[model samples]
Target: MKITSAVVSVVLLVSAQNSFGQFPAEEVSRFAIKDFTFESGQAFPTAVVAYATRGRLNAAKSNAVLLPSPYAADLHGYDAFIGPGRALDPQRHFLILTGMFANGQSSSPSNTPAPHGGPDFPRVTIRDNVRAAHELVTQQLGITKMTAVVGYSMGAQQAYQWAVSYPDMVESIAVICGNAKQYPFGVIRLEGSIAALKADSAWNNGRYTQPPVKGLRAFAIHYAAWSQSPVSWPRDMLDSMSNQQVDQFLRSLEAPALGMDANNVLSQAETWKRHNIGDSPGYNGDVEAALRAIKARVLLMPCRSDLYFPVADAEYEATFLQNGELAVIESSAGHAAGGGADSQAIRFIDGKLKGMLQ
Candidate 1:
């Protein structure tokens, strides 16, 4: 294992590429399988996983990269980082942005048919996502193997699963601001979100006719506080927003989120709550053994100030990888440090991805 830190800001020198990499088109394609069986022994008929592809596969079809969606994000969420000269570099490699199962686009609670729709949506794990994504790559895209699987946040969890689930299919992986397993403290935080939703009288047992506005707002407040570092509020946000505006901004996030199904959030939360690459086949829930079994060249990018998935988590995981490098994103932007959301962390993450692809 090797360790490195990126503390300098390269925003000026990185402008041209970042501007060029802003690919706008977000076309979606869907792949479906019948009788999709879940790890929970649950099954859903006609399970579909949606994906968006950019760039052309090389002559050998070996330049495929699988980009899984993070928590509450769709394929379009990555527009800032998926252009010609950007980190993903569509002009150079075939990019496959895989949507997480419960992310509204794919077979989610809001999209599925009756009975299995809404609260009835089946439970899906990280392994299940990797399994479906593997099928899409091999069967639909005709990609034998991936050059690398790249993801951030919850997407990073999927990338870790991809490396372990089908070690031979993935040559490398890039995981940003995520952990191999759901830390107990992390679960407690998510459970708070669930509790807030359940407390809403309008929830009506997940069958509410209207959005649980109050609950969603409460959840948004929770996210505003915990998703970011304590230092970010005074140092970063206050620099751009007034105290009153910051209060309104946090409240505003609830509206768009309300448009989404509560069950969808819960579905994603369940998967994230039990994220353990080791829990799958072969590893049998042994975390250390699963990390060792990953054959991919691993690029572990962790946010220095991320409360949920800190750099310390990456340092510990790197020790278990067969070939791993830990690149520290020194920022107080928290878990969002690497998704091209902020300048400092974006430059570091983009530079890292370029090196990984090369």
Candidate 2:
């Protein structure tokens, strides 16, 4: 799907400006912390983390729902399922938004230090990202415990990390569209995406001022294949996207004007690839053993047709979780729907969250 320049510009501008303008009903906020140190023993020369909150923290600060942003997604992704009468209603639970590392927003290469801003930012892993979130919830918000830490895709990986890293801090975890380990095939695909970016002459070894926009678009296209369901690309979605051919849908999702650095994407993808609860510091244990260590009740929400995180992945991971439940969002909407506000996902989230919090 070849997105016309006009539509690209519009989406980019809106996405750039508010990130959550489409969901005005929910309250959100943004913040930046200079030289944010990372768990990978490195620090971004400069970093910013965008966040949004709804409702209010109770006296004991236990009614909090920590939701991290998905890859290439902003906090708006959860709006439909988080309002009043919804699973994550701010009226009852304090919802906190955390931007994933290198999402081209909040502490990303696009907003990092001068000249080297784009891809030159330091590498940060899922573990590193969660630790920073822990700081925000504990030190900044003065919260000692949370009702839940929930997310989809990359955000889900962080949720898992939170459960393992601080089992005592989180009471429940809702993970949608993700798994415990990055399968070798998935790793290869991510590597190919970075390769597509680096192969472009514009990359200049991550030093290009205006890195290859075309290459970035191609990378986006490459990711689209992995992100969406194989057979569910809607005709309307295809029409809205500029790509003339169904094959080009992913390319249309790629926005070069966003100034998202290729190196940054590569680093973050690699960071996610390194995710593993068994690798926890001082935890020389089996994968199942580490997952079993998590005391938080778990909800594994997988899209029925997710191409990237297949249902089998979630099923295997669920078995390891100490107190876990498997909830499938039966939809042909694929992986994109996992990030979307689908009704089935909403119901699943609502039921699981309400039960866990209760």
Give the whole-model CA lDDT for all candidates, comma-separated.
Answer: 0.77, 0.71
lDDT by residue for model 2 over 322-348, one digit each (tens)?
799998888665666566534565576
The lDDT leader among the candidates is 1
1-358: candidate 1 lDDT, tens digit per residue: 1111221111211221122113343467889988989888887888898888989989899889888988867775465577778878889989998888888788888789888988888888988998998888898888888899998888899999988888888988999888898888889998998888778898888898988878777765565556656766543434556777756654554544555567787788888998998898888789889999889999999988888786777898999999999998898767656665467777788888899999
How many angstroms is residue 207 displaced in model 1 relative to the true structure, after the best TM-score fit? 1.7
Query: Worst 10-residue stretch by lDDT in candidate 1?
Result: 1-10
Off by over 4 Å in 1: 1-26, 235-247
Query: What is model 2's C-alpha RMSD?
Result: 4.8
Q: Per model, state how many residue pairs clash.
A: 1, 7
TM-score of each: 0.89, 0.83
Whole-model lDDT for model 1 versus the true structure?
0.77
- Candidate 2 lDDT (Cα, 0 to 1): 0.71
